[model samples]
Target: MANDRRMTTDRFFGGVGERLENLQALFKFVDTTEPDKAELQDWLESNTAAKSESTIKAYVGFQRSVGLLELEKDQYQTTPRGATFADTGDPELIFEALLENVDGFETILQTLDNEQTTTTAIQASLREAYPEYQLPQAVVGRHLEWLQAIDAIEKQQSADRYELTSFGKRLLQEKLDQKPTIDDLEIGSTYDRVELHEAYGGARYRGIAPSADYPYVFLFTGDSGTEHGYKDEFRGDTFIYTGEGRTGDMEMTGGNKAIRDHKEDSCELHLFENNDEAWSVTYLGQFECVDWFEEQLPDTDGDHRKAIRFKLEPVANEVEFTDPDLGAVDTDELYERATGAARTDDEATQQTTVETTRTIYSRSEAVREYALRVADGVCQGCGDEAPFLGNDGEPYFEVHHLYRRSDGGPDHPDNVIALCPNCHRRVHHGKDGDAFNQELISRAENVESDSGK
Candidate 1:
């Protein structure tokens, strides 16, 4: 009876060992299959002895707690710890091994090959397989998270799908090549001219093509809008003005004779500012104004003879001249001084102070109240009250002189009327004051007649 009891104890220990082995095999399958919980349960029940579903579940939970498995999306996968164990066929030995050598990192490579998954998917799968693991989710998440942060694993937008990154594939290929001194070095060098040409196929090296020539010159002629019927001429390669006025018309014959002489020639007439206070000619293209030679007088009527006179206004930043010789030219400085002098003179002429002090009054409130009473608080222009409503719901209006004081208009209340600011300003400041006043009077008369009715 003593021997039989000892035999039973030994069998009990053997069964416990077998159960542990089965659990390890289950974890290996999860690492390899990366199956969801239900699929894993189905596989375990079919392959193993009659273990209860609850027992399998408890074992799964225990494996997760021990950091041997991971749970993700209701699925189970091998953790890095479990993967290491599977690769070495001994979890305790791998746990004790140092990770200094590249061979120690081979576990990750082997896991990748076994699972055919991205580092992220592998990590996430491990979390699902070991849902109750004491290891922080951050630790399990770090491998994939770091890879993704460094663009070593591709993350899907809204799916659990992941794939090896380009860098990861390159690393694996490099490992397979067995090349010593795998430096993972980037060649930090700029391309030479020939190398760039070869890489881009000499595309960018093609010189910029020349633009087509547009040689058309436009000549504009118009009457000077003066008593003299002489027309003014403006010539340019294009018909656009440079805001410097007509460049070609500053000639003696109003540019007409000069343009006629050089009708088919290409020339530039640069009329720079002369010393005179008005516009004067400088650098006359290739033409010169000839004096009217009285010695070569023709027997012609005065009206038949051509007389040319040109006038140009000094624009901003352009030169001005006061004499015909282009001497005494003034730049914009003369304009500034002249404008300043005029302003100073005007300021000096203004009244220093009125002899009698007049009391200033704002009749805005009175005008607003009176206008609202007269027009029933409506805009006289649009027949609406929207313009008059203040933030506190009071009608707004402005007081205006019936006749402007500038135009001998009285400032008395009798001359004033309650009108919307628009109508008020229009009556005093607009072009048609009489018309606006007439309309106001007509409206007042109509209101009075309605009151009587």
Candidate 2:
């Protein structure tokens, strides 16, 4: 409701000092319809609640100086700049305009931009740089507060200092580029293309491509010997897998996206682990995605990335294959070998970057049968007999690892136990699974460690 036809650029700003509240009050005052001097004074008193009319007059004079207001005859009206400031309420643009027209404001901003100095420190620095302009500490503080109010700088409460925001940085740099647009990938569109290995591609591609749950089929060859990777393993009906979300310094954005897309029973995932040969991988099978959790995995690069580990159960009717090389080694013999290599101290557990090749050998069935035979048709846990007979007319029981093989626990008789299906599931998915596992570890007489059998 203000007229600016007679305004000139030279008459734009006059009384704008470090006190930015004056400009804020002026903007609020001009947002109303045309008001006379008395009405304007009343509005200023009611809104800003300034004790003195001189302070209010100074704010009004600053607005008139900057062509934001034009007080003619007796009525006060908003000029073009005032109307624009009232309409947008954008602090950054207002501050930028002030820098262009307001004297000494830009000098203060340039002196303190991107510097993490407090108000007192800024005054000291400014006095050192410009002794002629002996600005008081209060003036510097008001300048800092005004910059903060106009979104020109960020205040770090914890540090008791100041830092330049992105917008503030741009303002100091003398240009503000238009906001850039990002063309995000469509929900169902393929984001990345992965080449399935020649050996496992056939079995891994059992489901349709680009399913709602599985946007893509991922192939993970555990951590590069020296780098970090998901610890993935295959057991009877489950593929104990970790989510692929991180690597050394590079985050696998594609892998993270896959994790986000995964849904229980809906996301069909494939499992693969490293074999002995360099760059060789084995396709375990299709798996139904399950729960996931955050884990801190050691990164070979000395820095760490937040990793996500996932649990998966083998999908029904999927082909199962074991490493032919590890065929049924005798359990007692395997036990001796495992205990011999069992870690003796914390040194073996500390994560380090080792530039060496690693191998993934399937769990030995011979070890399972030996544990069962040792149990002699009785559940090692609960001291109860087998729940039922299998199709082969043998007692049915599940073999469990007292110490998880994933955590570098050896696959030996000393580390394995024979349990009924109920007890087996309970130890893995039960609320007190960890305590129960410890109990089983303590009760087993035949289980051996590095010290003895």
Task: Give the clash count for model 2.
Answer: 5
Q: Write the per-residue lDDT of candidate 1 for residues 1-453, one digit (tens) a residue.
A: 000000000010113225435545776787788999789888878877645777777646645654567888877888777776666565232222211111112234334542346545555444332222232434434334433433434556677555556665655455546423212211221123232222211112111100001111112122222222333322110111121112222223313333232225332122211212221212211121212211111112213232333222111212222333221223232332222223355543563442433232122222223334445566665576747476767677544444432233332333345556677668755898789877766765576588662
What digit string (tens of lDDT, one per residue) describes model 2 on residues 297-413? 655455565665555654442212222333354445444433444433673455234443333332344456557767888998888999999897889988888866434444555
lDDT against the true structure, each candidate:
0.38, 0.54
* Model 1 stretches with alpha carbons more than 4 Å out: 1-14, 91-453
Q: Tell me the number of clashing residue pairs for each predicted model.
A: 24, 5
TM-score of 1: 0.19
Model 2 segments more than 4 A misplaced: 1-32, 128-130, 175-453
Q: Residue 423 in model 2: shift from native, Å?
A: 99
